[model samples]
Target: MEVFVARSHPVDTHVGNRLRQRRALLGMSQTDLGNAVGLTFQQVQKYERGFNRISSSRLFEFSKVLDVPVEHFFDGMGATAVAAKRKPGRPRAPEKPADSDLNTKRETLELVRAYYKIRSKSLREKTRDLIIALARD
Candidate 1:
C-alpha cells in the first residue's frame, strides 16, 4: 500500500497570490471575502496561503466577486509553472521573494485602493496623469 501526501502545487500558490493581490487591490478584507463565499476568514487565509486548494466552482465565485475573469488567476504564470511535474520525495523549488513583485506590495495595493476612492472620474484621471508625469521626470 502506498500513502501519498498532497503537497501544494506551484499553480495553487500562484492562484492564491493572485487572489490576495486582487483582494488587496479592491481594498476588500479577508472577512468580506469569506462572507461572500460563505467561508470563515481563516479559510480565506488558508486559501490565500495555498494551504487549501480552491475548486473550480469556488474559483468562479471568486472571479465574480473580484470582478475579474477566471483567467486572471492564471495570468503572469510562466510556462515552467504551467508544466510543472513534481515527484514524491523531491524538494519543491523555492518561491520568489514576496518583495519581488510590485503588484504584491502593500504600498502598491494601498495606492490603488486610494486612487479608486477618489470618486471623481476626472480627479482620478488627473491623479493618474500626475503619477505618470512624475515617473517620466
Candidate 2:
C-alpha cells in the first residue's frame, strides 16, 4: 500500500528564493549546499525552483547542515503569509528601547555644567559627594 499527500497552498517557490539568497550570502553554490544538505545539485535545483516540497524533518536536517536557525527561513511576513510558508511559532526580536532610554555622554555633560556653575572648592566637593551617593546602587 502507498499513502498520498498534498499541499494546500504551495510556497516552495518563495522558500526556494529565500534559500538561494541565504546560500549565496553564505557563499555556497547549489552543489555546495546540496553537499551540506545531503542532496544532489539537481535536487537542490528542484527545491530552488519550487518543484519539490520540503518536509519538516528534512528542514531540521537542513538547519543543522547549514548552521542556521530553522526560523531563519521565515522572517518579516504577514500573519497569513508566514503561516502559509511554514510551521507555527516563529521567533521574534524584541522591540527597540526608546531614544530616551539610551543615554550617551549625558553624565559627562551634566558634570561639566555643574562644575562650571560652582566657584568654591567646598561646593564642588559637596556636589561630588552627592553625585557619588546618588550613583550608589
- Predicted candidate 2: what Cα RMSD to the true structure? 17.6
**Cα-based TM-score, every candidate:** 0.86, 0.48
How high is the CA lDDT of each candidate model?
Answer: 0.89, 0.61
Error of 2 at 126 (Å): 43
lDDT of 2 by residue, 21-125 (tens): 556555578899888777899998877656687787877876777677878655433355445544235433332221222221345445565575799999899
Number of clashes in model 1? 0
Error of 2 at 84 (Å): 6.0
What does candidate 1's lDDT look like per residue over 43-137, in tens digits?
Answer: 99989888788999999999999999999998998776798886887767677865688888999988988999999999999999999999999
lDDT of 1: 0.89
* Superposition TM-score, candidate 2 onto the true structure: 0.48
**In candidate 2, how many Å is residue 55 off?**
0.8
